[model samples]
Target: MTSPQSRKVSEPDAVKLPREIKVLVAAAFLIAIGFGIVAPVLPQFAQSFDVSVAAAAVVVSAFAFTRLVFAPLSGWLVERMGERRTYILGILIVGASSAACAFAGNYWQLLLFRGLGGIGSTMFTVAAMGLLIRMAPPKARGRVSSLYSGSFLLGNIAGPAVGGLLAGLGMQLPFLVYAAALLLVAILVATFLPAAIPVPVHERGQAALKKNILPLREALGLPAYRAVLTSGFANGWSAFGIRMALVPLFATAALGAGPEVAGISLAVFAIGTGVALTFSGKLADTWGRKPMILSGLAVNGVAMGVLGFTGNEFWFFLVSAIAGLGSGLMGPAQQATVADVIGNDRSGGKVLATFQMSSDLGAIIGPIAAGFLVDEFSYGVAFLMATAVAAVSFLFWLPAKDPHP
Candidate 1:
């Protein structure tokens, strides 16, 4: 078998994107930039209310908690409302909530706003995903997936560094900026994006009757979906959870660092992710999803382990970059696996929701658990635990069978 890294996607082939797809990618980049802007500061913002570490962690997980419980609802709304309306509404909701968070008077208020924002987050996320799966052409799936993910990756890379600078200006500035960006995107989406009609409504009912929305039971049985879920869980727990929630606190408590360091660390991870996405899709196509996922998991686990042991800010940045690199490597392959499972079928709303649920569940649980671990023992222990969780996710990946590969 040829190595995944050796796969060749021609330059012209890679750039051939539909007009609608470009808009979707831009929308993804805008949302990610907004979220990335807030990430490094949200934890410390919670701490401002004299909340405990666990409480601070809750601020992060609250978004995921709402996402976890409401994924089904999001999917339902997408079906009823159509992707464009749902996507717009989702953006507006988050924009309003984020603005509220920026002006929140107390810890509880901030938490409330953050939690509410998750509902909007889930709405747009699911809608965008639904669109991407159907819109991305089969021949250019690899390139399109890369671009979609890459847009967010690049936004994340820029957002954190800029957010850090903004944080220095005012802690609330990042939240406000995020709110503004989201609202602006909502306008852009409403104004410019025409609906992506994969199938006419009349035909959709017939198509829908042909296949019931893929059930969780059915999704769980597919080796590829299961593997994709496992990878998502690990990323949510380890990268989105521990790394985002715990690392800044660790930097402050252990390394005498500040917001700049925290923001830079997260930015480093985005940099690594951005770099790998440039080639990961083509690699996944040529080499197979399995090898890329395995390589990514191994690299991510090792980096997480190293991060747990290191004390210096430089080491923290280096290890965080490595973890991001790993995430980038696995991200597209796992996402492609999901698209493969769903195909061009219009009945995958529930199936996609269930797949998303795994990641949200991990994000919800990981930080809260890690925070408690930190309270019980130390930051080092919490990170090591994340590494262990990521390591175990591979077991699920092993039995997966990729259709393309």
Candidate 2:
């Protein structure tokens, strides 16, 4: 097949976004909504099967674990099929899996279905990010990242609140709804998202090969890429691993707050992240990426560490919001830096996938590690440990060069 237009120019020179990027953003919105619909119910649903807390937790990690294992394959597929097809297939798999989860009669069945869904999650996530870096111009890359992430966050904001209500109806109901939502998303993405224009034949062999496998050897040599790996890990550990796994429990046990309080704290965090996104992208575009990356790591480390010391709900809420804002500050810059390092290439699939893998690994490990600490020592100790992880990530940034500069 002939490559269309080949994006003959670098994104920094392009005046507007490609059609597929916009469509992908819309698809992200739909998928996030479904994820949100399931988020509030997944654990509770697992518990309903009379499983242990650890077993219930497995229902959650199984997805991330599989995603971690299969991310490389997802990168390979995106290189071969192009982002559009890969994305649609990923969504379809997730939808099918979610629907199967709704009917799962045993704990093992639920676990298996969730694991299946994780494989699909890796496919769409890596493919979509790869597509974004391929298309977004350097000057506007930050803003584009913000918009795409913002769409997902906005969906998350709406999803949990609705998911809570749906759970009240029945635990299985949310899964069915999530499945249906994903199905709809797949259909929309397939219809509206255009095929990526092929690279020129002269560049095809190398580009296609790169898409299938990552340029690990070359990427590792770049300080900027190293920094991205560091930031991705810290972000997942502090932002998601701790926040999702420990925050609610901390709110309930330490602060004496109800479930509603945890929800509010998370909402506050999301709000801060959203507000920061409004200008974070523009700042990254103008100020350079390293400064943003460094500041975000430092601020998040401070915020995370403080979580262990807070005694009241107000303080807990405030710190959570601060951490979220730190994430906001770094999110666009982090993704933009990766895009800059890859520098308009398809062979970047492996690089990007590896970058994504670092974060997913953190997300998988962070909670388990923190939970172990909490069990062995205390919540405060767990929080402090997570803080140190963030600090190490910041230090990694110290010597790293900014590709945008």
Measured with C-alpha atoms, the lDDT of residue 29 in candidate 1 is 90
RMSD of each candidate relative to the true structure: 4.6, 5.4
In candidate 2, where is summed lDDT lowest over 10 consecutive residues?
6-15
Cα lDDT computed for each candidate against the true fold: 0.80, 0.84
Q: What is candidate 2's CA lDDT for residue 127?
A: 77
Name model 1 segments beyond 4 Å from true. 1-15, 39-57, 102-107, 161-177, 196-212, 252-262, 311-315, 372-381
Task: Give per-model TM-scores.
Answer: 0.84, 0.90
Model 1 weakest lDDT span, ten residues long: 6-15
Which clashing pairs does model 2 show?
A: 11-137, 210-347, 214-350
Model 2, span 169-241: residue lDDT tens: 9999999999898888887877775665433233445634354434778889998898789889999998878
Model number with the top TM-score: 2
TM-score, predicted candidate 2 vs. hidden true structure: 0.90
